[model samples]
Target: MSTLNIRKITPTFGAEITGIDLNQPLTPEQEADIVSAIAEYGVCVYPNTGLTDQTHIWFSRMFGNLWTIGGQGTRLSRFDYPHLFEAGNLTPEGGISTDEMARKRRAGDRLWHTDSSFTKERTTYSLLLAHEVPAEGGETGFADMRGAYGALPQAMKDRIEHLEAEHSYLYSRSLAGFPVTEEEVENGMIARHKLVHTHPGSGRKSLYIASHALRITGMAKEEGRALIKELLDFGTQPQFTFNHYWKPGDLVIWDNFCTMHRGGEYDDIHHRRDMRRTTVMAYPPPPVVMDPRFKDRFDPAQFEAMVDA
Candidate 1:
């Protein structure tokens, strides 16, 4: 592998990486260099990848294992790619969803959030490629959480240093006026993560505010929400942010731990903005124990009954 040419997209956060193609196999050294680039810069953009779905997935696997959305498969109706998820204006039926609820659900992506924050297996990195970019507006905005944490006042930083927040998909969905069933709330999808993430590889601290972060644990609901809003505002200031305008065959990879990204607004009804994403899981899910102590929980009959109920 030769020296990787990297240019700063923004002074604080994003980098444009050249001299690599996803369609071809990357050498071990090249792969490591890309990972190093991600650790150093929260987000990196590779222009003109022209990668097939298989090659796009292969490139993603070089970084880590793929993370799939629980109980959901590929959203592209025409495409049978299993390793990626649609992050675009198109519906599962290959048409735009005209339904209000579906539109509201998709509207939640415009909020600043990190992927898979609501799951137990944290999303390590998110790689998105644009195959069909809209003509007008389909940009993705990313904010630097590390720079956000660094800019916070000492008192503010001290206050949230040890705090934890409850992240829930239903919580963010409700914020956009999307309906949720009582059963869905009962079987809630939620996870707890530190308010400030200590980035493992980079050895940097980043404020972990997300739209999915419903509330701070042990704090009053209203107060916790206020805190989240405050942190999000501080973390997304212009100085610590970069917005990527989409182009066909462009790939953008971001470390979810140190950045918050959101989909940009576009004419959903007229324009087609087809984007696919491959998320690298932080680690695989923990193994299920089949000990007698956990017998009742693992019992198939009991699980079937619960599902029926």
Candidate 2:
């Protein structure tokens, strides 16, 4: 493997990595270097990789287990791969979907979030490959959570150091006015995670807040939401974010542990923005630690019923 060409996109976080063939198998050294790059920079963009869907999924597997869409084989109509998320506006007939549910779900992607945070088995890295891009306004914005944590006042950091938050996929989609369906609730879309997470490989601490994070455990809902909002507003300041404008053949990968991302607006009704994502699961799946307070909202029986039904 040749030495990778890495150019910084931002002073602090994102980088463009070159000199690797996505069509071929990655050497162990190359793989390790990519992992280390993600640990250090959070986002790596490989411009014009010309990766096919098969190659994209293959490359993602080199990192870890791929997250199956929706914890089941659930997928959008006309999309072939169950392991890949169809993160686009196009429907089976290649036009923008008219389905209200699909449009509402897509709208929810505008919120800053860490991938799969609502699942007990959260994701580690997400590799998104662009197949089709609109002529304008479909950039994806990413915020540096590690930098956010570093910039927080000492008192603020100390306050949230040991705190935990309840994350709910249902709740987040609801915020976009998408009512939760029974299947989503039964899919175990709620989980609890620490407010501050220390990356094992990088030894860096990052704020773990996301749009999926509904409330802080043991705190009143209104107060917890206020604090969460305050943190999100501060963390997503211009200094901490980079918006990636997509081009066809671009493959961008980012570590979910240290970043929050949201989809930027495009004329979804008139143009197409076809992006597919393969999510690599965090190894040894994070334990499901439930807060009794949220049990009413996230019942174990619902999941059991889902399994039974």
lDDT scores of the candidates, listed in order: 0.81, 0.83
Q: Which candidate is the best by lDDT?
A: 2
> What's the residue-level lDDT of 29 in candidate 1?
85
Sum up the clashes in candidate 1.
0
lDDT for 46 (candidate 1):
93
Local accuracy of candidate 1 as per-residue lDDT tens digits, 50-149: 8877778778877765654334533334455445787876777777666676678888898999998997667889999999988888799999999999
- Consecutive 10-residue window with the lowest summed lDDT within model 2: 294-303
Query: Per-candidate TM vs. native?
Result: 0.88, 0.87
Cα RMSD to native, each candidate?
Answer: 6.9, 6.9
Q: What TM-score number comes out for model 2?
A: 0.87
- Spell out the clash pairs found in candidate 1: none
**Candidate 2 off by > 4 Å:** 70-77, 180-188, 285-309
